[model samples]
Target: MSAGRHGRHEPVYRALELIANGLVRAQRLDLHVTGLENIPDTGGAVLCVNHTGYVDFLPLALGVQRAGRRTRFLIKSEVMDIGIMRFLVNHTRTVPVDRSRGAEAYRAALGRLREGYIVAVYPEATISRSFELKEFKSGAVRMAAEAGVPIIPAIVWGAHRQWTKGGARNMGRSRLPVHVRYGLPFTPGPDESPERETLRLRETMNSMLLEVQDSYGPHPPGEFWVPSRLGGAAPTPQEAAVIEADEALRKAEARAKRAADRARSRGSRR
Candidate 1:
């Protein structure tokens, strides 16, 4: 069965909460949450989160559940394509974002917000390989502005150790430390530009992340999944920037070489 056309995911969402609760217990994951009361209990709002790892979603969902509200995440369309997972995701009222047609997802999110439901958006758009906060996209702020709802910034630290884009796997760690903190909800300033609003959101998120990291104690030694700032093997933000720049240079060189090779071949043929 699917969620009602009106977008109610209740009973099923409640069930999802139960399952999430069980998963936390079974996995022996340690979750630390703060500022959850900032989530508006009776109105539409946007939860803007940082993208760290694949496993991060569960904790974020649990945080929202604990806040006494049901939330629909803006998930990748590819996840909804999974045959078995599609049914569950659909009934949970998650919004599917086709990268090519991102506007549709924005509209769906706005619609949900208008219906007085909570919507979660990852402003980074994708997981950061460096396990650090990435540049923010304007989507979250745009949605909140257009929907006339407040935006709550949520930062989750430590999930990157479980599974990250860098391919580090530390899921076997018992009682893995994870912290989720929600910042106070704030609405966009009147006539605020998307870039300005996004910048504000990014600052709030990064600050929250740093606070969580500070209180969580030192990270696991020699773990590639840990952020470099915490003494792990993950690259620092500066290192990641250099790596990205080097990659762009390498790709440019390869394209130039290919073009030259093609030119030489055409000349020879002539």
Candidate 2:
């Protein structure tokens, strides 16, 4: 995989991305990635992806990983307080902001990007019900403008299908083909407010999404797509090794802890 814009050559991003990517692969789900050639080879960048359902985040995450950039995401505050999710997200360096606290969240998002992390901000801000794109928000625009980083518009369609409005309860079906589209990097003029700038960026991103849809044509009742040829390099050794080691270590640690608990139980019986 190519190094991200920051020139840090991160394996952590690669590892985390690899683990999540299995979700895409094991299902035999194919990704149609377009404009990937447009992703900058090097510094901090903003990725604004379409939000649909819960699965939407994972597909987008995996897609970003495929692009070779580890993105720090702006996550909901409530999600941060959950048991293991907090640990996982924090470990990945995701920044969580309380939806209730608007100003603070905005500042924090920009601050993290300024700190040189490629942050993913959802311009839709919240989930949408519309089939087409909805009104765009400016959180992303403002952050990029303030941080002075280029912004990349991304759209992930078809994710809403597996768990459609009222579909099957189980996540069945393998190789659920998904589309991940990206647009060339662009920045808003410094004169605008974050909100205004965010909308401009969102509009451009929406265009990219629309373009992809046009190229692939309207998806079936539940689908989205990319025009990319279903081909790319094989998963690198570093990616595979990290994934194996992390899973093994997690299992070993869990087993050790379980053994300790059993010993405690036996001693307590005494």
Candidate 3:
């Protein structure tokens, strides 16, 4: 869903307003967005969120839309396959990513930000079984560093509980309280190593997550474990298992996808 796909960008502004208003009405959840002033009234910027629950996406976008800005997400290809979602995202300038192709995703993400659209991507790239931040993928760090835009750290709380541990999927009209918090944008230091960039971003995200969580009284157990600093040790063994599984699944999926693509190409050539 490239920004250029849509002709005449006027509808995008009105449409986002409708979507944001609808999301707030339907969810009936309270939202408190801090540092809203930090977001430049206009221009391209990256909003990095902690991915946990399904509702997190809407909350993340709602914050951007609320601040009177258009948001483009570097999302999964599967999401784009949905008819309504694809239409909405395309009009909004989202870049759908097939993680199997890292280089392609990078190019697409960079392209959107360069085009003066606010972009969002999750550093962890997947939800945590336990509500603790996992070791982040370097994508957010790389994208933010290369794009050279203010990366705003956002945190979402309460969406994780909407999922039942058994299915851990689908919340059909489920009533879940949600909170969104945005942190002041920060510039990654000059000559920063990928490691440093990743860690710095992680720490900012961690703080924002904590602030959002704390705002929702009665902490969701284990939210306290993520330190105020980035690249900190992961949670305990029980929690680490989920993070490990997420990593392994992502790697396996990426490999399988590439293999399939190569096989298809070879067959086509034959």
Per TM-score, the best of the predicted structures is 1
lDDT tens per residue, model 3, 1-270: 233222235586566667666766675655555666766676567788887665577766767756666677787888887899888777666788886687997898888777767788888877664556777888776777787877888887766555523234534455556777778887666598878888988987777776666566653333332322323232554765666688799989998999999999999999
On a 0 to 1 TM-score scale, where does candidate 2 land against the true structure?
0.71
Worst lDDT run of 10 residues, candidate 1, spans 1-10
Candidate 2 off by > 4 Å? 1-15, 193-196, 221-270
lDDT of 3 at 62: 68
The clash count for each model shown is 0, 8, 0
What lDDT does each candidate get?
0.81, 0.66, 0.69
lDDT measured at residue 222 in model 2 versus the true structure, 0 to 100: 26
Best by lDDT: 1
Q: Write the per-residue lDDT of candidate 2 for residues 1-270, one digit (tens) a residue.
A: 232543244556456666676656666666787777666666677888877556777777665656666677887888877878887776666788886688887887777667666778777665543434556676777678778888888888767666643244335645566788877888778776777776677677667767766665444432222111222122233543455467669979998999999999999999
**TM-scores for every predicted model:** 0.83, 0.71, 0.75
Between candidates 2 and 3, the lDDT winner: 3
Model 3, TM vs. native: 0.75
